[model samples]
Target: MTLLACVALISAAISFSSIAEPLTSAQQNQVRELIRDTLVNNPQILEEAVNAWEQRSTEQAGARLGKIIEQNKDALFNNAASPRIGAKNAKLTLVSFTDYNCPYCKQFDPRLEQIVKKYPDVAIVLKLLPFRGETSQSSAQYALTLWQQQPDRFLALHQRLMSKKGNHTKGSIVSALKSTGNDNLSIDKKTLDEVRSSLRLADLLGVQGTPATLIGDQMIPGAVSYDVLEQVVKAQLARTSS
Candidate 1:
């Protein structure tokens, strides 16, 4: 049979199966034979079907994530506790969930900084999420504590921490704090609780890895190219203006 005939046969079989009435044994045999012969002659059709299914699934997932973002806009954007940088009255808000010890997070910093420098009306929030190891956890707790006591020094402390070459430790955290003029800061129960809360919030946002970025209703995971980032930002701006 021709490819077009094969497709029509498959469509007919599907349409018949969807109906309430049952098919006779001969009809079932015929449909099964058609399907088997189609596949044996043209295996590419199965691959095409699988690709279509995967594409649909991805689109559905993106839609669901968009809905989630709209529902949690307050928590994602306006939280006083989240460490923010860039223009305070910016039109665009970029929220990044990162681990101190994540190499990709370190790599992503420059791209993020580049955008911040280029866009005068853009604000970026760095959400501390430590899932690397003990050192990362300690550093995150210290950063959170510093944020609670002195939110102003967060950017400096973050820069210091990100610029460090080696693994983060208690000493590294202290040194970063001191370098950022937060030498007197100490991690207490309140700050520890804040760190835990941030982790819980990350979980709620479906953040499973380091360097997850949220721009408007879109989520970009991992290290992305500047072009992709710029495209998303422009698309969002266009959408809002429209």
Candidate 2:
């Protein structure tokens, strides 16, 4: 038997013994000696065992995440308070948790636009997570306010904000607001609550950083390439259609 298989059998035996009669001191020593000799002879078993454990852990994590997504589907996808783009009733939907001041989110902005243009049946729900600091918080509040008061102008403001690089200043934010004819916008209680809600959702999803994209059962972190984004979208579409 392979060393890994032997290790599994040893673990099973120990569990069985615990439920019945515990292993005697001599039997425990024998098991330990067997493992020691196996490892000494075939050191690669350690690497194989580690890889197997990691794969199982990853699969378990993915399954847990999928369950969470399923439970919160309405909040993630159909929230009227969230800013959204692309088809209204899409066959495939993507949820993105982003910070306006996050450079990676800025970098990923155009790629999202490209996806919208290319796939008419796809929709993107934008959750404004402003965990970067004050600048991020301000932008998120403003964006949410615009989405609440003037939905038509929200996309223009959103694209303009995402197009900007680095930290946003008061002046830069005001300029973008004015350009979108929303310079008079002010953060209201509702907007603040919405931003807070997004933050909580991000935390629940285990999103540690900005530019986290959710497609189907997977939550992909970082600014993935357009090709990768498209591939995931297509795969999701296929699954849904199947």
Candidate 3:
């Protein structure tokens, strides 16, 4: 028999042996020796199989999230209080949950902005989820405050904060705002409440970290590539046009 066929037979046999019935002593010894010899001679096959398995698992997870995004569309996309960028009446919308101190979110922020610039008809919503610490929470509160009081400058503030390194504290936040020329920054309780609401919504949506993005009926769990962002947007546009 061919080596590949032998490997497949041994794999199948071992897989079914546990569930269907226990193998006899001779059968167990034969299968074990076969697997051991095959692996010792050609160990790369195991690595190949493991890689394939991981790829399949990731694809399955993405598919599951796509369905979940569709199920929770209204809450995910229709929050009027969410900080928005780009055209308000845009046909394409991208919603992102991010923390101020999240490195991935910071890295993706510029890319997201570029996408917005490239796609004039795309609207991007920024949902603050401050799970990092007090720094993240306080920064989000200040962000929400800016969203409420000076929305025209919110994007600037967001860019500044994301660009900042080290710990995010009240002093850091205030310093960033002052650098942006907002001398009198006052973060209020209502803004804090809004941040809290965002956190609750994130929990309901099963978002456990920063940089979770939603485009159409798909949730991308991390900082996706520019190509990925473009593809998702184009696909949504095609679907809408169709």
Candidate 4:
């Protein structure tokens, strides 16, 4: 127990002892009042009380956070505040935050294609998560600028970054961009700075892994399977219909 709590307990114990030792009735009342006041105002007593409450309710509290996540639903997926793709007002939107150097992300790309083709109403939004920092950030910056310069070439550039073996070197990225018929991807000083700003925002979204999809509030991390993804989409679609 904390020192303050120990002191309070000892004070109460002495008061009880006084009661048993034939203290006057008035003195007993005064001792009880003293104990009451200490409990009411003591910081240690308050901390212990709070800890007890949390110990009982922590599991329920976690479950409630889960429910809040579920109910908010669409607001989480349609986070327009972050980078997005596909139809701006799509009925079914799948938001993915990914890092180029993550191999699992490449595996996820094909699954996304299946989802999009299966559901035309569904739109895919891609957000950059160049999370490895420094070199990763630089690679992501180059990729984003290229997307801005030529969005049509984004899919090809994405493939190169995902497929390239070894550490994601600037040389590899430049080579991939060149191979995609965008030989003049000269990231000028101003463009590099702009991409850096956007990348920072992606990092703040708690993006740790690639191929992470945010279907409504339910965020599925890693390379989730098509069947698993399809189940979530169906449930979300059901909510919309209702």
lDDT of 2: 0.88
How does each model score on lDDT? 0.81, 0.88, 0.82, 0.67
lDDT of 4 by residue, 82-101 (tens): 34455556677776777777
TM-score leaderboard ranking? 2, 1, 3, 4
How far in Å is the alpha carbon of 41 misplaced in model 4?
42
Worst 10 residues of 4 by lDDT: 74-83
| lDDT of each residue in 151-206, candidate 2, tens digit only | 88899999999888788988889999999888788986677777877888888889
Q: In model 2, which runs have C-alpha deviations exceeding 4 angstroms?
A: 8-30
What number of backbone clashes does candidate 3 have, counting pairs of residues 3 or more apart or in separate chains? Answer: 0
lDDT for each residue of candidate 3 in 1-242, tens digit (9 for 90 to 100): 44566668977997898688799999889888987887788778778778878999979877876776676666667766678999888888888899998999988888889988998889898889888899898888888888888889989888999998765877888888898877587777787666776777677667878898877766677888889878988999788778
**Candidate 1 local lDDT, residue 184:** 82
Q: Model 1 over residues 1-242: C-alpha lDDT tens digits?
A: 65566788778777877885778899889888878988898888777778878999989988888887787677777877777888899888998988889888888888888888888888888778878888887787777777777787777888788887767877887888788888887676565565676687678778889899988877789989889988888887677668
Best by lDDT: 2
Return whichever of 1 and 3 wins on TM-score: 1
Quickly count the clashes in candidate 2.
Answer: 0
Which structure among the candidates has the greatest TM-score?
A: 2
Candidate 4: stretches off by over 4 Å: 1-88, 188-207
List TM-scores for all candidates, in order. 0.84, 0.89, 0.71, 0.60
